[model samples]
Target: MQLIIMRHGEAGRHSLDHERELTEVGRKQAANVAEKIAQSDSKPSVIWCSPYIRARQTAAIVGDILGVPVKEKSFITPDDDPGRCLDALLENKESPLMLVSHMPLVGSLTTLLSDGHRNGMPFMTAQAVVLDMPVVGPDCATLKTQFLP
Candidate 1:
């Protein structure tokens, strides 16, 4: 299974954290990323987003381009654990999972996925982190990638 960790694009600097929508540039960034993903062989089976407006908008833009549906998942909230969020995705049957969320957590999740991530994980705006998970047991799994996007 592949996990696509996506960060919401540039948001309004003056807007509240919970309500900020993507800036014009952010919208373009989202579209470009979406188009790039649509051209990929590893298409996302599910697109999950944080309930935050910016994240939701970003997810919707990508979802539309990829013809994949988008939904707000609470587990991906800013306060939620990135590891648990990733775990929830692994439990899902979706092969290529896309998650749109904020920072700190994206970096945190990337660390959890990469174990040590000694090289550091900094996902640029609208950047992607493609992750591969190998099945360890019927209900268990392990990440096996150091690739970036």
Candidate 2:
């Protein structure tokens, strides 16, 4: 399985975190990353994103560029357990999947899958990490590349 874990684009500050939306620059950043992915061989077959507005917007940009379907997932929000998210991913059979989410979860999930621990590498807004996994489990994936926008 090829997994793309992405941080949502930069978002405007809001009193309610879930209601926060992307900034204008965030849209461009997402578009830049999407264009790059669309040109690559590892384009996702489907996009699963956090229900937060920022993540949904970011996922939409990439999905439109890659001509893939986008689905909102409640479990991918910031602070959600990476292990549970991984379990949800395992239940889905989509290969070459892209997950658009927030900072801590994306980083934590990436590390959990690739390094088998939550000592995560930090991710910038609109950054993406690609991993190739023979099986989706702890320490089973190899880092393929990273895309920065």
- Number of the top lDDT candidate: 2
Name the regions of candidate 2 deviating beyond 4 angstroms: none
Against the hidden reference, what TM-scores do the models get?
A: 0.84, 0.98
- Candidate 1 on 75-149: residue-level lDDT in tens? 886667766776686568877888899887777776666664423357788887777767512223244332222
Residue 41 of model 1: what lDDT? 69
- Which residue pairs overlap in candidate 2's backbone? none
lDDT of 1: 0.76
Sequence-dependent TM-score of model 1? 0.84
lDDT of 2 at 51: 96
- Summarize candidate 2's per-residue lDDT along 4-83 as a digit string, tens digits: 99999999996599999999999999999999888888899999999999999999998988999999999999999999
The TM-score of predicted model 2 comes to 0.98
